[model samples]
Target: MKILDKLPYFIVAAFAWVAIVSSCANQGMPTGGPRDSIPPVLMSTQPEYKALNFSGEEVQLTFNEFIIPDAISEKLVISPPLESRPSILTKSKTLIIRFNEELKDSSTYSLDFKNSVVDNNERNELEGLRFSFSTGDVHDSLRVAGKIINGFNLEPEEESLVMLHKNLHDSAVYTLLPNYIAKTDKEGNFLISNIAPGEYHLFSINDLNNDLRYNEGAEKIAFADTLIVPDAEFHAEADTLTQGLDSMLIEGHTHFSPEPFFMRNFTENIYEQYVKKAERETKYKSTFVFNETVIDSFGIRPLNAETKDWYILEPNEEFDSLTVWIADTTLAANDTIPVEMSYFQLDSLEQFYLQTDTVELVFTEKKEESRRGRRGRNEDDEEEEGPEPVPQFNWTTNLSSSNFELNNDIVLTAPQPLAGIDTSAMLLYLKQDTLQTPLNFNFTKDTAAWRTYRIAYNWEPETSYTLVIDSAACINIYGITSKALESSFKTRAEDYYGSINLDLNNVPGDVLVQLLENADQEEVIREIKTDEDGTVVFDFLAPDKYKVKVIYDRNGNGKWDPGSYQDKFQPELVSYINEVIKVRSNWEWKHVWDLTPDPTFIKNIRDKELEEQQRKEAEEDARRESEQGTNQRQQQNNMFGPGGGISPGSLRPSGR
Candidate 1:
């Protein structure tokens, strides 16, 4: 309500009017000149120009503008490398390099700055800067170039090591020292220059341990297989040895290592051998035979029990064999009993000998003494039963849902919850047709309480099939039996399929591509390798939604390699394109993928060879100099008496 409050409204109105007038005046008016395009320039060197026989410990290089340091040591190659690594400082406009070791005498040293200097703002690199100087004459100017490839996939392996050895032999570089080494760039290309050429053994290896040596176990190596020298050219191809997959379970019986078991008599031995006859039918079973000594002991036990009307044992006197018999009226497929012998002895020498079926008999023995006082009795004085019998579960499948599609996961839903069953005992099988025998199935338990189970099959299209769930295949908790079940179905036609094409960028040719269906994301539909152009295509895919994945394939192997924590190798980089495509009938879908770069370190072959040659020359020069010094000393000693040995006294007396 004060005059000041009304005055604020009037002031705001006046300011708004003034802003509108100013906006009208500034409309379409030119602001400033064009942006400056001047590149960064070098200002000065700390030691100044052509500083003769510069003996300073450090050199400072200053630029007109701020800059960032690239992989300095890796990108910066020093000919006649110093014993100690030079420290590079980039605190401000000045870049300083401090040397801790003395320089070689009368030698030309060249520092090849390969893309290690870049401007701070736009990261524009200054490539191929050479700093050359000589204490005596001129610098060496030899060069070498080569490509690096992955040992496993036979494709370009970026960031691998390419080394050169002065001495050539299969085991030389692997065991002995290498002269020099360098890392490959992202394109798997390398170049090394400023070298004094010499006979060298060129080798490329993925030195996983960074030991600068070709470790046969830890590194994959490729060599020219001969001595190489200046102006010589050669190509080396690296490939990995294929590893074998572990054995798969074929039938119900697994291979058994033999154990010793004694038999009561010849009849018992024969019975024991016959009991395992079914084991021979298994695909992986081997022939088994009982030792002669084991057979002899089987004849020693007394066969004292008499044959009853319900159970009988018939001996074949001529063949040393016995036939177990049960009265036809009481005998059944599931009925079984343990044969008792008159004599009590260790039965630990039984040997299996036979070829019949693939079924194994596993017996669980119950000692009478363990249950002696625990027997129960009824109120009427009759002994009560030990325990209630467990219920059995048997499965039956509808043929219509049995045939599996590549895109669709087949599910078997139980009609009711199973009771008192050992679900683990159940076996599933598939058959090409009703007339053909069944093939073993690898099934996994899905839900115990629901009695649900699932099996994933790498099924092909248009295949007729039958599924079988056998009776007596599963034993209940109380050892009750379940009846076998089976079904049959034919797959749909193959015309309902499609194909997919993937175009990948920045992806290695060795990258692995996998197709997965939407229904079972964890299940793989198919796996393919990317071509050199980074393109992967999957044909004959069933109609469904699918996802694509690309793995870096670090070893260039056509598969993903798992990382080991102990080795300190991180998991191979993986990228998912995340494009969900619905492949319809007779349709084709194309996808493009730009893979992310992996963190990798590789050696350059050309640089390594060049460095090796330079190192050898340096060593040879040092050796020659040492020999000359030794000879000069000996000559001086001879000129004077050995004891006088060019003493300062001799030189002073001559001057006086």
Candidate 2:
């Protein structure tokens, strides 16, 4: 009986322990006192930073906390870079690096670990870690700072390799590695410190093959036309635009010459022109494609058929490709057709020659449907066949609805290549109170479409109209004529459209302003060229979101062009207004775009804006993590059992 009395107390104590264990299990890993936001600090170095007469092949860095060398091979940049990558290892809080190549004598070597080392637990990144040592008695200490910019869009090019060449020859970029090098950070900003003061040429290479040298046609490169001499600023006045910049000191009151260099990044685009692909996809069509735009004579002809006009030639806007539509019925129905293609082919010596070849094009089919009927029925089926489709010409129109948009044209398209259209048999009528009135319209061929024709008419707003095309009005190359076709539609009112006017202040010469469909700026809805007064207007725009893009047509070619590195010409810069230009019904929006700032000024401000944007993103991420922690605690405290009571399942503790 005494033992039984103690059992009641034992059961009560067990229940109390169970409740505590359940609470802990649901809480997840403990908060552990906020987080380790502080990055690892460098406490000591092997031979002391900036030490002279450095003779060892190994370098070591000890930090205040444990560290991780995350992707050190890729992130560590050493100038006068080594021919081969070094081996990097971490032990506890120390990072050790062993060089594989010999170091240059009487030269200063600097290693920049741009945000590669991080604390062990929280992965806090240590930013802008640098170390310098010299093989001789003296160490170089001058610095140069600059940025790499995309030539076309004027955006910063991030993580590009900035190189300084002492040779200064044009061929040095292709032959030798740079004397001093540094990599751009996430913001496309780089600083090469501990450089010996001397005249140096600046260049940036994307380095796809990791050779540290520029490879034409395989890498993107930027060069500074003028050589840069790194010097210190003693008492120079700062520019007004740089008032918001952080004050950086090299020595005492010393700055990086107070003038940042800007490098224009571009591709040479000297890819050799060659046929990329050629194939016949259907019974009636074949396509041929080339790598680049064909600036010379390019032609294709059907060799199997004897008829002169065997196919209709259709060239893309770029003129680098052709779509051949077989017009001859015999050639179109052939199982295999031979065709001859002639085009300019580039040789290894960069010379073009007219080359011709004849090849056979054969159509293919999937295995399952190889012997099946048109409707996927087995060929051996003994079912009665239905009547064949009528031999009428297949054609379609854009009139899908009763209401018509004001900006659209009445288009008619046929499946096969069209031979001609009998305009005399076409009729357009104005329908009022069931009374038809003949209206004058133009049947014009749309240059941008294939096998298509457009009907041009000055349609009255809110008025219904009927269009009639008699039989045989449209004839295809196969001698088939279209059947009768009639459609009725009402034009939209003027109140459904909007207008936009732009006042371009301090505009550059020969500017092409384009209004886009959205902020993506992929499709241009309307475009206008600014006159000498720098004013352009776009009238009768439909209600939609829009954006504006301006291209500086420097060559007056009516389009934007990329730079030619060999010609020493920079690409024309493009500017964009990113605000959502919303067009509402019957509203006219006017905007004054100030183009006073040059392209360089625009690029510099854009870099700062991106920096501020990244800062806000970092803060938002921290807030979200904090809220998640609080939510987890609340979930632990409010957790309920499956059936509303602390039953066996809910009483499950940590281990048992």
Candidate 3:
């Protein structure tokens, strides 16, 4: 063995050292220890928990370990809640609570440390720890519990305030704070304990601003119709976990479980009347929007009515909106006209009272300037001015096809609000075989929509119809004339429409089924009411994807009512058949809806359908991959030729 042999051994030693160092570096930094799970434990307290005849101003709690006050001022709840929140402080392992108000006589007060006391280092919460004291001789121990959910959608409402009130007045919920309040948990469960048994009205409010009182616009509220009396019996039992039989044992008390109360919180939009805004949509047409519904048609006139008569008013059916037409042609483009409008509006008390508002009407954009071509001297002398271009207006319709159905109306909308209609210039013709016969039709303005007109005729199926409107058939507020337009449409065969047969189970007294485009959009294509047999047939439905929503009409009113808060009523229950029913042309879709089912049962059906669809897609993808692999193998065989290919006697042909 010479120097060369020694070099090989040295290289092997160097590699081994590098591998060991690399492996050691991969271990990274060391973790300290297992996580801390034990929360802070109470060692002692001044005037200890459940102290009787307590009149102290400050409570000092000492813990076994160092504790931190994590948002104790906000998280610490004093029940019945104090007039003012108390100040919380920490000194080493001790927590101090200083009450700013005097405690009531003979009343029990509980300071709930709802996870506010945490270990200093690990931040483990001391959950559900409470300190209770009676200012008088003994404590008044009674409990009430309930749950809260949204009125329309049955989703749990968290952090809502459930309160009790002794006063039976209907206005008490609006004017005064509650006697005892408890916030709802994440599951909408609430418990109010240590209450003196008495007759009390129960209500729940969102209390969004934390003002304690119910606010009409900012809060949602729910109330129970019947007065609740906390009379459930409770007894004490020996503590098994804390104390042994040989040790001095204290008893732990448990209350009897009562029928839990359920409340549906709802918000009402009280009638408040005010104009939202007035905007000029076109050159001579302006629209007005109101916060509340209007009772009558509004009057619009120029401020100087004696000099200007350009404005005319049209009120929509809902009375919440209206359009104003300015017919004065002398008004220049891009100009705004000031006018005063008078209308009957709802006041604070919901009475229709007359009110007036001033609005500014703006005109449309100015017309474009025309360019002139080069002209001879004679042509220039003759003045190359052409007749003023006709003010052009276009009309469009909401009809999907030229052939309108007997059930559908032909609605046409104008570019500007029309002041006058020339019905004689509009004609309808019925095409029977090869002969086109003239027919009479009536035109009426649709009061529900602005600048819309409906043409009605005795339409018959299996017949083609053509509608023709000559130029100047309608005159706008600016005196603009509509262009001549003609359209032809044919009616569809009766068999082309789809039908739906629904057999409902566990149906409420009255059921209202709404056929919607989808679950998310909620666009109702049609709605029908069914009888006790829970049988409903919806005919003449278009071929599309749809969902069925069933409303349990609890009040037998034939409609779903969102419950009134002050009236202490629960809203009507509603559920949807989550299965997406695809109705093809000339097809009939039938479904059975079970009303008395679990809330998530419909969602499960939808999820199962989705999973099945995914499974089919996966199989199709695998088939495609297999075909592609076969095609590649065929190409390889062709490239390699017969010599390189498998022998016919030994190989099997591919199967299709």
lDDT of each: 0.53, 0.79, 0.74
Which parts of model 2 have CA positions greater than 4 angstroms off? 1-30, 236-252, 302-306, 364-387, 396-398, 424-433, 459-471, 483-493, 517-521, 542-544, 594-597, 601-656
TM-score of each predicted structure versus truth: 0.41, 0.79, 0.66
Q: Residue 513's C-alpha lDDT in candidate 2? A: 88
- Sort all candidates by lDDT, best to worst: 2, 3, 1
Q: What does candidate 3's lDDT look like per residue over 43-114, in tens digits?
A: 999887878899989899999898877568866767777788788888888889988999788888777676
Better of 1 and 2 by lDDT: 2
How does candidate 3 score on lDDT?
0.74
Model 1 worst lDDT run, 10 consecutive residues: 260-269
How does model 2 score by TM-score?
Answer: 0.79
- The pairs that clash in candidate 3 are 402-489, 403-489, 403-490
User: Could you tell me the C-alpha RMSD of candidate 1 in Å?
Assistant: 29.6
lDDT of 3 at 168: 75
**Candidate 2, residues 342-442: lDDT per residue as tens digits?**
88877878688887888788875444543446557644563555555557685689885465877678999888787788898888898664566668887
From the highest TM-score down, the ranking of the candidates is: 2, 3, 1
- Candidate 1 per-residue C-alpha lDDT over 1-656 given as tens digits, one digit per residue, 9 for 90 to 100: 66665676666666665665465342676847765444457778766543446556777778888877756755665545555678877868887777778877655455666678878766766765556555444454455566655432224556666665666655676676555555566666655544456777666666676566665434555554345555433343323332243543333322211111110000111123222121121111112222222233232111232434433333332223433233322222222332332211334464443232222322333446335346754455434535545665556432475345555434554433333444444433444443555455556656432345566566666776665555665553234467666655666666777889887787555777878765433367788776455667787687777766666777876666544322324345555554466778888888776665533322221334446789999999999999999988876566456564433333321111
Error (Å) of candidate 2 at residue 508 is 3.8
Error of 1 at 229 (Å): 2.4
Model 3 — which ten-residue stretch has the worst lDDT? 647-656
